[model samples]
Target chain A: LAKTTQPISMDSYEGQEVNITCSHNNIATNDYITWYQQFPSQGPRFIIQGYKTKVTNEVASLFIPADRKSSTLSLPRVSLSDTAVYYCLVAKGSNYQLIWGAGTKLIIKP
Target chain B: SQTIHQWPATLVQPVGSPLSLECTVEGTSNPNLYWYRQAAGRGLQLLFYSVGIGQISSEVPQNLSASRPQDRQFILSSKKLLLSDSGFYLCAWSSRTEGPYNEQFFGPGTRLTVL
Candidate 1:
């Protein structure tokens, strides 16, 4: 499993966009970058996933650089309800194997 | 549409007592099941995974054991609980698909407190 590095915490205000970046320098060719959002006392939910370039979903967007060593999750117009921990995960295929990082605590202030 | 179910939502057990947590998947068949534990203020730790019935792979060496008795049913058990075992347990399932399109869906989670 590849290790991921992310900021321990971040602060943002409502209606502002938040972008959290993760670095996986040793990412393998088969590895895919995935992001998950976890609220207090709730299980992490899948936000977005990407292998290269950019991928957009109803909730967020994922941007992967050409090197595939790093990726960013962009949340548009974040709200107070978005205050939660965001985890960056790396995995391969349909296997149940996943490596989870400490996650970036995003505090969406009013 | 797929849904994962786990119970009991919260458990408070005494140390040295036996523990059993169950997880089941619905609307999907032959799904790959996983057991993960999230310590307070920490990240998730992969405990065990199963690809099929009677096949389990453990990622970490611990007192807990996992079993898959049916296609969509998985269980995490311990003969005797420990204080270190107290945490939030989550069960997840993913379809057997090729490539990197497989995204796991998680259950509500079970909070176990060992006293």
Candidate 2:
């Protein structure tokens, strides 16, 4: 598992987009970047994943630079319920363990 | 569709007491199961993982142990509970296919409080 770094916290307004960036300078070729969203008293939920370039889902978009040293998770039109901790991870294989960072707590205010 | 289920939404145990938490996956076979603990204000710590029935791997050396008696069934147990063992426990599983890169699906976590 490759180590990842992310902001500790962020704030956003309702109906606004929130972008959380993560840095994994030592990421490996086989490693893929993945993100999870966790709310208080609940399990972490899968957000998006990408190896390179970009990946998008109904909920969020993941953008990876050509260098692949960093990535960003973009959440569109965040609502109050979007307030949660976001985790960034890098894995090489199925058995590849996940190393979680402190996570970025996004508080969506009205 | 596959779903993971965990028991005892919350537990409060006394020091020196034994502990056991169970997790089972439905609608899936030969899946990889994992146990993770999340402490307040911190990231989740991987406790154990199982690849097959009766196969278990411990990421952190501690009093807690994990077992897989059957496919899709994973258990976390401790002979003597420690205060530090208190935290949010999460169960997750991923398909064995896709060669280890499959995204993991998590179950609602169990909150443990040790007295």
Interface C-alpha RMSD after superposing true interface residues, each candidate, one decimal: 2.4, 1.6
**Model 1, A57-95: lDDT tens per residue?**
899999999999899999999999999999999885445
- Model 1 lDDT tens row, B1-115: 7889999999999999999999999999888888999989988898998888999999999999999999999999999999999999999988866533467789999999999
User: Candidate 2, residues A27-85: lDDT per residue as tens digits?
Assistant: 77787888999988888888998999999999999999999999999999999999999
Stretches of model 1 off by over 4 angstroms after superposition: A93-96, B99-101
Identify the leading candidate in terms of DockQ: 2
Residue A17 alpha-carbon offset, candidate 1, angstroms: 1.2
lDDT against the true structure, per candidate, is 0.90, 0.90
TM-score of 1: 0.95
Tell me the tens digit of each residue's lDDT in model 2 across B1-115.
Answer: 8889999999999999999999999999999999999987788888998889998889899999999999999999999999999999999998887644668889898999999
